[model samples]
Target: MVQTTFKNNAVTLIGNEVKVGDVAPDFTVLANDLSPVSLKDSEGKIRLFSVVPSLDTGVCDAQTRKFNEVAAELGDNVIIYTVSMDLPFAQKRWCGAAGIDAVQTVSDHRDASFGEAYGVHIQHLRLLTRAIFVVDTEGKVAYVEYVPEATDHPNYEAAIEAVKALTK
Candidate 1:
């Protein structure tokens, strides 16, 4: 149970906490078109999972945009995903409005599978806490960062460097 805060108030997160060396857990999220997407879908590629509460928020928007900008430089070997509890339709709309082409926005609104499997699920709110997970080409978790505060940004530089390290 990883403890996190939303607006400085402690919140309970219910799930099996994933660590740096664990095998990246398999979970299903819905793509913009309601297609089921699993971790195995991007097998043999470096995956950066940007977990956010909701894309409608300011911090989530910035986080997704930042990764979208970096995705171009990350090369085809890397696949960046923005996971949120927002509905698939809303995610599609937000991406289009934001011009976010590089990062694929997936919705966990259906069953919160990604949230529970990744240990970022906010039990009370039914939303995921802000976090970043970098999965290597072989499906091993290389980096895990559960942002302490839901509203604050994760260590972007560190997460980017982690992916860069695996790319090399």
Candidate 2:
């Protein structure tokens, strides 16, 4: 379990927490098309997992768009995926409305197994904490960033740099 305290308030996360150098655990998530998409599907490609609480928030929306823009520049060697708790239908609508076509958006609504396994599930808030993970071709995590504050943005530049390094 992952424990985080903010301004004297404490929250605990239940389930496995991903860390740098750890082999990313494979999980199935619903894609925008409502089809099952697994982490193994992106094997042999640099994977960028952008985990957000919801697409409805400003920070989450900004993060997704930022990754979408970066993914376009990162080329085909990297596969960028955004994971959220929103429904597949909602994700599809949000992506189309936000003009987010560069990165794939996935939903974890049916079960939070993906979120729980990744240790992004917030027990108290019942939402995921903003986090980012980069997995190499072998499924080993190369980078990880868990935003300390739930309301803040992630380190976008650092994540992009990490992805670039994986390509070279």
Candidate 3:
């Protein structure tokens, strides 16, 4: 279990905590159309997993949009996926309303598979803790960030730099 903060209060996160150089755990999440999407499908590409608690909130919305903006410049070899616990329909609606097209939102509300595997599942809230995971083309985790607080934004520059380095 990992320790994180919710509103600055200590909270426990369930599942295994991933680290750089570790192989990413495979998981399935729902696409906006309710189609199943898996990590393995993006094999042989650099991928960024931008995880948020919920998309409707201000910070989460901002976080997703920021990554969406960065996605446009990263080229096709780098895929950015925003994972959250929101339902697929809600995700789709929010994306449309927010004009977020660069990043594909994946719903882990079905079973919290991604959250559990990545050790960002907030035990009390049943939502994912704010985090970022970058995987290399070979499927090894290249970087990880479990934001200390749920409401805070991640180190965007660091994550973006990690992906950019992969393209070099």
Backbone collisions counted per model: 0, 0, 0
TM-scores for every predicted model:
0.99, 0.93, 0.98
Better of 2 and 3 by lDDT: 3
Greater TM-score among 1 and 2 belongs to 1
Provide the lDDT at 104 for model 2. 94
> On residues 51-140, what C-alpha lDDT tens digit does candidate 1 reach at each position?
999999999999999999899888899999999999999999999999999999999999999999999999899999999999999999
lDDT of 3 by residue, 1-168 (tens): 467898999988989999999999999999999999998999998999999999999999999999998887899999899999999999999999999988999999998899989999888888999999999999999999999888999999999999999999
**Mind giving the per-residue lDDT tens digits that candidate 2 earns over 71-117?**
87898989999998889999999999999988999987777767888
Q: Please, what is the whole-model Cα lDDT of each candidate in the order they appear?
A: 0.95, 0.86, 0.93
Best lDDT among the predictions, by candidate number? 1
Q: Which consecutive 10 residues in model 2 have the weakest lDDT in total?
A: 1-10
Q: What C-alpha lDDT, on a 0 to 100 scale, does residue 18 get in candidate 2?
A: 89
Name model 1 segments beyond 4 Å from true.
none
TM-score of 2: 0.93
lDDT of 1: 0.95
